[model samples]
Target: MAKKAYIGVDGVARKVKKGYIGIGKNVYGPELLSTAGMPFMALANKYYATHYHVDQDGGFATLELDTLVSSPADIIGKWWPDGSFGSDSVETMITSRIRTAVSYSGLIIHTEAYEITEQTVGIARKIRKAYVGVGGVARPCWSGGELVYYGTATALSVARQHLAATSVGNYALFGGGETTNNSNVIDAYDASLTRTNPTTLSAARTQPAGTAAGDYALFAGGYGSNYSSGVDAYDVSLTRTNPTALSAARTQLAGTAAGDYALFAGGYNSRGFSAVVDAYDASLTRTNPTVLSTARCDLAATSVGNYALFGGGQISSSSSSAVVDAYDTGLTRTTPTGLSTTRYQLAATTVEDYALFAGGNASGGYSTVVDAYDASLTRTTPTALSEARYRPAATTVEGYALFAGGFSSGGYSTVVDAYDASLTRTTPTALGEARDQLAGTTVGNFALFAGGYTGSFSNRVDVYMVS
Candidate 1:
């Protein structure tokens, strides 16, 4: 009988000529097998004849023909016929079977020393976990635990906990009062809590005007045991054992600091209400006092860029005057512009280039009207306040001009009202204490009200922190 062979053609068993193989409809050419230098059909026949058994009917028996015709060790050294093999064929077969088994088993294939070129292993299944080289030298080795990882068996771990934290937007408040010592007291607050003690003033006083120059707060004339002409210097950021006094003693002075100098304007002195203006430099030396054409007290004063303005106040006649004066600081005092109505003891705050003058004592007692003036002393038509008052303190906080603690119609007021530059006033908020003649200063985000007279003279210091 001619040598018989069973071949798999498209997964179906078929009998073919011993020297030929069929693929699809056409039988393969002899050159196709000959050029490849292999009798594929003959090899298949030999494999089946030697390994498979014949059945009772003389036809080839169903054969368990899965046994290898060549050992893996043997296949390693040669091709099928001449005992020389194609490159990596055995390794390819083994790796293919391994990958298939691993996939079928649903397990991760751990590997070592696997080459990672653009081809071959690059395209291999799950090769990321595979090993390469015979000695397992190249491997995906991890030295540390899950919290750590390895690169070349070196452990690198991350911090399981966090690091230290820091803070921002923090600030300090300086030069105010507390609940004791009627005068000569200076305190500081931070973060809503008092951070410093009341640094004793050189002399006890209230309603003294203050201006900050660097770390120092220069306090000009205010009512002490008497109307004080004495100017005192307190280091706003430091504890004071001693304070330097002014060349002249006066009170109800309006002052503002600019650059290295603090300027004090019209105030009440022993000579009565005076228009004297004085400038104190960094060295605490006072310049010769320049006189204003109008002598007044309880006026509002502020520095706008290069010019200092002194607005409505009580004239020497004890009547409120509408005069507005501007001091060049570099030059002598000039004639002042008059207001629509006379006002005194008013609260003044600067908003950009304009100064807003709010509630003060007008002709009929306390007037609620508010006024605006440009740095050049041009006045705007007055807007009315929510409540008419005098001895009220004004400060600009967070773009709003706040008027706080003054004597109104009934009595002393703890009411706090805020006005925008547009002259619109908001509903007032009550303070912790009702007071008048209070010295108000702003430190950071908080406004400090210190040493004012309540129904009785008070040493109570209250702070308002604008959130």
Candidate 2:
């Protein structure tokens, strides 16, 4: 039940002539009880009422529930009472009501008064909420401020291998791979970690390279029944358009974006190893940039600052190469100090100021070397991975570079190694399944490793969330 009441100018409680009663979203008694009358329901179900009384009559009405109720834990953080407090007396009245709301009703509302500046005094402040994680605890400052409703073990719609991953706007996408046959499925995860199947690729091709620039996420070059030069571009809204294809149709190429350009460099074509470098600008304009110094296949690519770097790949079937190629925003090519180890199938990602290239097969044995390049392209060696593995999935989230699930001497690995911004290494929880050839990318606060071969093709998606 609710009563018609408001606070007087003298800070005294008084009954008012007009108001309504409401409970759990339903307005029960009296005149024209609309949505605004149902306070409990309007609070987005955050609190429940054993008994109720609230007032919304005229000058600074307050929440007057019989006994306040809330969850076991207090919703901590700065919050502003909805409307304007015109005078100091009104502010004091509102603070008193908040105290009453917390004291009688058990809701631990923190009514800390912020020092009002010229900017903050007259403006209305928004009520902020947070994302709740597992164990019903809220994780601070994330999108979709609601209870943790999404479930884990989120797998791709199809099982695949040799897939490619990239992110643009609010979504991270995994595209093109081989399953029973070549698959064109593009699985998407949005900011809320909800999965959606966007339009499939125009061509079903294995080992297509994925990257993003401006409003577009692009998948370019790979082998279908034949080598495909087709370039499929998806905008931030997941709307698909075919950009101009690559200069040469190829497979095992590397793709990355720097500044305003998305680039595809070095791959095996029908003509054997090709050194072609194709670039697409923000407007989807295609240009042939200076190619890689060495023609290679299965190279790794990552970007940091204003440059994109492609490093370490099989220069020939019998051996790997340490050749590291870089392209600045202007598409000018430079050969940086190569990786300390001549290796291919290495994985690369960015963390803070460095672009790290980690573990790959070098010689006959798997290599554990980890190399880092700063924004100025200065190279440094970081602490190596706990396990020597090749083809691990790599991505960054919350300043941490995560390398997950690859193959080593003992066979398939479930180990997940992480490196912070300072290059300090730590091992987090392992993947649910041991696999390799999976694709990895970030969306919001999550780093996801999806789809791989675990003896057989697997559709498992392992998510590491920074809460």
Candidate 3:
């Protein structure tokens, strides 16, 4: 007679003889087992195959078996031995093949691994509940295909549409064109300009100084068609024609808006570059026109709070001087501060509390060095521009000061460079046109260029929008 062997399921072990053991009260015998596939038979044989069996006398008997039974040591060494018939090591070896077969048959199995503790099931249930409301069906931990869930329908639709649309490149508003020797014909354009002339000068002239006043604009001291001493004004909000002229005739001057007045300083007159400092009120009235301690022209000027800075220019004998001077708008002309770097035909703009000056002709050649003066007119160490140029136009936008359109070492440049408040210099963007001695103004977010000479002279105006 055959000896009996022991088998275990769900932690319950029992001895069985030649007759099959009943699972769930259903007997699995030869007839019932024959209908079962080879896979089920293999699973049973792996876990329950026995080489040594118990005899009726309670002694162990050896049986000749096609497969060897694993020792208890070997069984204990296997991972997941009690949980499943195959060990993790064996499962790993057949994983690729099993995955391939299942994929080919379009079948998938969901398996989850977690700590076997009382709290685990509750955590899983909560996760399922949270995900299910969004069109996700919670499958049992043992069941798996691919996890599917629905997102916000409206948001998904919008995102999909946006992805399908065209991509756009980074763009900026740039100075376009300017007027000729005649300042009266001021015109500037960008994609937004669209054939409309936004602002015009009070008179036709070149090398005039311009600055923004309280809701008004002051254009002072430019050579007219006849090089006449002319100053003009326009109500910035109304866009009206020349409202009035300056009290004096001067050209090649520098001016900055300080407080309620646009202070005009040092420029060439019939008497040559004067050290004169003139202030124009919002009513277009000139007052307290005082002579600067040092006479200069083709220089740069900017206002920071109470002080107006005048920096670098040619003296009466065409000699360039590196003199920086500052005048207090609150006080009269007696007191002025001096800058460390004296540069001429440079571009300057106010960034926060600091006024920056960059690129101009110094000594006999163009310079790349940039300098700054604080509200107190104290100098900071100068930085270098990527290129050396003179007579460039500078304007401030979004904490950045832009310098563009000037006579550079590479010739007249359409290049635009921005000086960050941190005093870092960046590579420039080329303008649509190459010109020098242009005037740049920032209104709202737009930088408008008017009346620059392109070798000879041009009447085209360009606008760059900092978007």
Q: Which window of ten consecutive residues has the lowest lDDT sum in model 2? A: 115-124
Q: How accurate locally is residue 110 in candidate 2, as Cα lDDT from 0 to 100? A: 23
- Maximum-TM-score candidate: 2
How many residue pairs clash in all the candidates, one count each?
Answer: 27, 1, 26
Winner by lDDT: 2
Location of the lowest summed lDDT over 10 successive residues in candidate 3: 159-168
**TM-score for each predicted model, relative to the true structure:** 0.57, 0.72, 0.57
- The local distance difference test score of each candidate is 0.53, 0.76, 0.52
> Which of 2 and 3 is ahead in lDDT?
2
Prediction 2 global C-alpha lDDT = 0.76
In candidate 1, what residue range of length 10 has the lowest lDDT sum?
Answer: 158-167
List, residue by residue over 49-150, the lDDT tens digit for candidate 2: 222233333232344332222421221111223434333342344344455564443332222222221211112222222234757844333221111212
Q: Which stretches of candidate 1 lie over 4 Å from their true place?
A: 1-182, 223-227, 239-245, 329-332, 457-466
Candidate 3, residues 174-237: lDDT per residue as tens digits? 1112232243543323224333334444455656666656665555666765444555454533
